[model samples]
Target: MRFLIIGGSGFLGAELARQCSTARHEVAATYLTRPGETTGVEWLPLDVRRREDVAALIAAFRPEAVINTASRSADWTTTATGAVNVALATSATGGRLVHVSSDAVFSGAAIHYDETCVPDPITPYGAAKAAAETAVNAIAPTAVIARTSLIIGDGGSPHEALVHSLATGKGRGVLFTDDMRCPVHVADLAAALLELAASEYHGIHHVAGSDAVSRYELGRLIARRDGLDPDRLPSGRRADTNAPGPIDVRLECGMTQQRLRTTLRGARQFLA
Candidate 1:
């Protein structure tokens, strides 16, 4: 199957490209800033905010499956509107589209969320992700919205990097104990996503890890795995530090477990 991975240079996107390429699938990936070479994956420059560019790329590449991994963590225009533009463009192609979503879509008031749960975002990032999910569903119902949590792996992830920095006193920050996430392994999430892209699964799917852990705990786990001093990672409550942020956004993956052949291990389990 032919695959298109938007923002393929990113952590999760890069993993997806590598896995797909290893599986011997025709792969085309997009990059915005960081450029790197991955064998068997064609990298292209694309700004998802530009509809014409998206259309043009799809027209030329003509992939059977399109995965939108492009995201702007802080920018509203690029995060929300950019995703909508991708949905509209992908809708035109009639190809299978998998919009990589975030567990941040939830307000974190609830402990567990399934596909049927309503999105009640509390933060700007959460709001953007929720908006993108709505737009993608409305514009392209055939598209699969894979809502995942903190992507982590042994290879220096953002979370891992932060842990390592704090462990060595290179970075100074408080790890939040109140904030909770699933924290799926990049390899596991990417493998499951690739399967979904090839299949005809529609609507939102919780494609995350098996364990739910606090941000602070996740950091400690990474530190422990990498042989760093977890004591160096100072822990703080999100409610105490800043305004009460999303406390817990744990995704229920019963459907995903039964549906996909791929197995998503827990962050702690995978790290070990």
Candidate 2:
């Protein structure tokens, strides 16, 4: 199968590209600016925000599937435009698409969210992502909507950023105990996305670790695993006095794990 990964330069995208290449699939991954060289895979300069760029990519690659991991949710306008461009590109080619979303789309009110759960994103980033999902679904009903949580692994991931700060004795200054999330490994997530791409399954699915632990606990685990002093770690504070971050991001793995043979390991054990 020929696969094209949007945002293939990012950590998760690179991991997925590696897996697909190892499987002997024809893979083409797009990057925003500087593209990295990957063995057995073709790297292209792609910006999903541009319609002409997307059109050219489709015309040239004619991929069987296009996985969209590109988003500007950090900036509302860019996110909206980028998501729409992705939808148009895939819809035009009548190709399969997989849109990567975040668990932030949830309001964190429910103990656990299923595919049928209504999106009630609180933050601007979350709102934009939820809107992107709706737009993609409208354009291509068969497109896969994957909602994931904080991803760990890779040297430059958010998890690694925290670790680097702690190792340098900077994280001891502050930590958010109230802000908790289930951090999934990038490698595991890549496998799940590939499985979904190969299947006829559609709609939203959660791809996160099995454990839902507090940020403080996660810090201690990472420190302990790396032979650092766990006691030096600072406890967490609320993101705001009244507004607390999400605590339980525990996702119930159904289609991703069962049918795809992709298992999201518990963060506790994985980190340990």
RMSD of each: 1.2, 2.0
- The weakest ten consecutive residues by lDDT in model 1 span 238-247
Total clashes in model 1, counting residue pairs 3 or more apart in sequence or in different chains:
0
Residue 235 shift from truth in candidate 1, angstroms: 1.0
Q: What stretches of model 2 exceed 4 Å from their correct place?
A: 171-173, 239-247
> CA lDDT of 55 in candidate 2?
82
Give the per-residue lDDT digits (tens) of candidate 2, residues 9-83: 887888888899999999999998788567898999887777788888877788889888877647775566677
lDDT, residue 61, candidate 2? 88
Global Cα lDDT for candidate 1: 0.87
Give the per-residue Cα lDDT of candidate 1 at 98: 93
Error of 1 at 46 (Å): 0.6
Candidate 1 per-residue lDDT, tens place, 29-76, comes to 999876547899998998888888988898889889988887887888
- Residue 159 in candidate 2, Cα distance off native in Å: 2.0
